[model samples]
Target: MKLLETIMQRAQQDPQHIVLPEGNEERTLQAADAILAKKAAKITLIGKPSEIQALANQFQLKHIDQATILDPENYDKMEAYAQLLVELRKNKGMTLEQAQKLVKDPLYIGALMIKSGDADGEVAGARNTTGNVLRPALQIVKTKPGVSVVSGAVLLFTESPYGENGFVMMADLAVTPNPTAQELAEIAVMTGHTARTLGGFEPRIALLSFSTKGSAKHELVDKVVEATRIAKEMAPDMQIDGELQADAALVPSVGASKAPGSDVAGHANVLIMPDIQAGNIGYKLVQRLGNAQAIGPVLQGMGAPINDLSRGCSADDIIQMIAITVNQAISLKHNKDGILH
Candidate 1:
């Protein structure tokens, strides 16, 4: 089965509570209704109760009733959520008045829901900007412990069988424009974990560079080589190799000739580009010219599963993101309890 199909199946089997901040938005509402119909997740919609109901009625959505809608202005936990937000941001000199004002916003409410353990995960960004969607999450839910930066990963579904069953995961695609060697190493480790937990495969990670194993000597190549060593140390058991050229990383014949006797050189399923410049250009080239389907810029390395969608996203996109968030939440729970799933 496809990775997405497997994810949806898993989500249905163990449905999680997902909060949708853009409750009255058309695509979000449609996606929420579809999710309820599939029993993929229990949804908490944050918006005005009357407005949500009116939108549901206008769209003739039957499953909207199955979702729990919390009005941003009148939620019972409004004061509690404000208090929590103030506490979280107290060191930043955030006053309770400021927190109360923010709690009225849907995005903040949704994030606070996750922070307060009222929800398992969150999916938003249909009508909001990426920065707007991420602000509350960063302030409240924050990054995972020991993780300092958040990176974005995209799952490239290609026709060529180069990666894991024709699926390759690329990272730092949407966030972290120019990461240092240390941050790059952290991105590598997080993306590997994402592959194992969400992609349902052992990760063979290749940190892409212009040079292949000292064939060329430059500071850029050195950075990649250092990142590779750091990633290996960070995740010693995982398969990771680096300072490899793109051709060496993907093509077996080229890999063997370029980086002899390296495990991940030819068999890498996750490709960590050196910077956002290379990553964004590379994925788009493959997506458009190579005729591959790119599934995400799935936001990883968060304390909880909170994903952002494109403003031009369809209901189907929202549904897919919801499933991705559910799987991430499950994976995070397992890791927290020291259980391998």
Candidate 2:
């Protein structure tokens, strides 16, 4: 509850509109009710108003009757958005007819809504696959400059922690597999920025691997070493180090002995795994074995403040996701030039 309140307080400070495309999902609807009640964000649901309202009533979610709901199929700006999509993706062979057809998807429409400034941020995936949400956002919202690869980062609040704060962030967990060194560097930079902006921690990023620097020799260790170099080059002012094992990265005594001179050795707030496999598995292991709270797998490097949710997430999970999205939106709002390197 303390963790939830910390996020909620920050989110409500400069409230912004958040669009939810999974309006028909009961958890999403219930979360919307909680969001509205908390006054932490303005709610917009992407679905037919009648149908969403019916479900909202069925769930007995407060403020549901008054929540703004949009039907992608019948939105008044559908033609204009289709034209924009065509123009935006003309290099990809998007015809107006095809754009018009794609706009029928709530995901696409929600992306367009953010693209068109109808909303500040977007969240979905309660019932959709990650690609279902990511594809449209990638096509419509795109990536911020210099962030060529988008990744997933989950913020873990632990019973006992290794991050500078009491929380840890693991990256590339739910998106982008087998990233190149440059791509991994960009992901690390984004995760560090996310830790500061959303996780309330001054970021110390550890580029994680199976071995501490020069402790073992493998292509995998080489990959982490190269990535660490690029991450340093990318964000010179940021504290980043590693080619570190999980133990060396998170355990203070081990970090001190293994990588004695590194600033991020034992106090990393953000952990950038070597690849998606390591990231996905590492986060889940900590989440289950360490009694940690995993809040995201949040989509980072999108042009806007859109996020994805686990399909199995509860209503409380949705609320927290919205809070995270709000923080991302605020960070973007305050720094349009770029939130981080």
Candidate 3:
């Protein structure tokens, strides 16, 4: 299938609300129009109304009828919510006025929308840093029950022979720079959950390192070992292994030889890296050199599936990320229901 087709498939599965925190109104309006036209999801563009309208007019784009354009300046209903947020973050050395000022930001407001159930999920970071995109979510949306750290997941796609497609997930590429073993374990568990949610399968997670089954000795390898142990203890039902090199994790022959009886040796769908430097470089290498279609450095482990888009992302990228976010939201809701039942 084509990229657009895959996007539409995911979008049709869960048409939740998607908030875009763009800098300029015209671009945001254009995005809103595209999302609505495609019947992808409910689009909410956050910016100044007048500026957005002017850009819509200038671009000869019809006003998005179904779209809700939000201006941070006019979100009066969120005042109480913002004040609460200020109080919550007071320990971070922010005064009430300072907190109020920060909460007025589009990023903070977008996060509040999710927290308040006004939006199902959000996609931001076109003009914001990864930290900027995640900070508000961390502060307001918070982590899930028992979740201590937030991480990132990238969906790597490639076409195999016979027209089949494959997916591999990498974690902590955009979030933690130097994750401790405990943090690595958290990332592995979170990435596994995300993969199962969006990729629609039980994920075999591999905690990747330079060594495979203790063949190499290094601090990083030790970290992966401890992380794999922690992850297994935390998620006893999850299929996970670690201290494996990429070749052993991905190649059937190498895995069969290196890890004789391991479950995740060659069939791992989720890979947790030791640090951001490796995760970032590895994903990009696969995308650029190996010609894989990389969908995300998507933020995960938060209360919701709030995502980030590269500033150079196209309208199609926004559409696809929105679809992924919607799927995540639905899956999360479904899991919650199952637990309650």
- TM-score winner: 1
| Per-residue lDDT of model 3, residues 4-117, tens digit only | 366567777668887877735444566667778777788788887787777777877664757787877777666676677767777886576776676668898888888888
Ranking by TM-score: 1, 2, 3
TM-score for all models, in order of appearance: 0.97, 0.96, 0.91
Screening candidate 3 with a backbone cut-off below 3 angstroms (N, C-alpha, C), the clashing residue pairs are none
Q: Report model 3's TM-score to 2 decimal places.
A: 0.91
* Model 1 global lDDT (CA atoms, 0 to 1): 0.89
- Please identify which of the two predictions, 2 or 3, would achieve the higher lDDT against the true structure: 2
Candidate lDDT values, in order = 0.89, 0.86, 0.78
Write model 1 residue lDDT over 48-139, tens digit each, in one string: 88999999999999999999999888878999988998899999999999998999999999899999999999998899988998889998
Q: Which 10 consecutive positions of candidate 1 have the poorest summed lDDT?
A: 332-341
Which residue pairs in model 2 clash with each other? none
Cα deviation at 251, candidate 3, in Å, is 1.1
Candidate 2 versus the native: TM-score? 0.96
| lDDT by residue for model 2 (1-341), tens | 47568879988887889999988888999999998888899988888778898897787777876678888778788999999999999999999889989988889988998999999899999999998989999999999977898999997888675675467888999889899988898999898888778756568889988889898999988888899998898888789997888778888899999999888787777889999998888889888998888888788899998899988999998999999899888888888323444
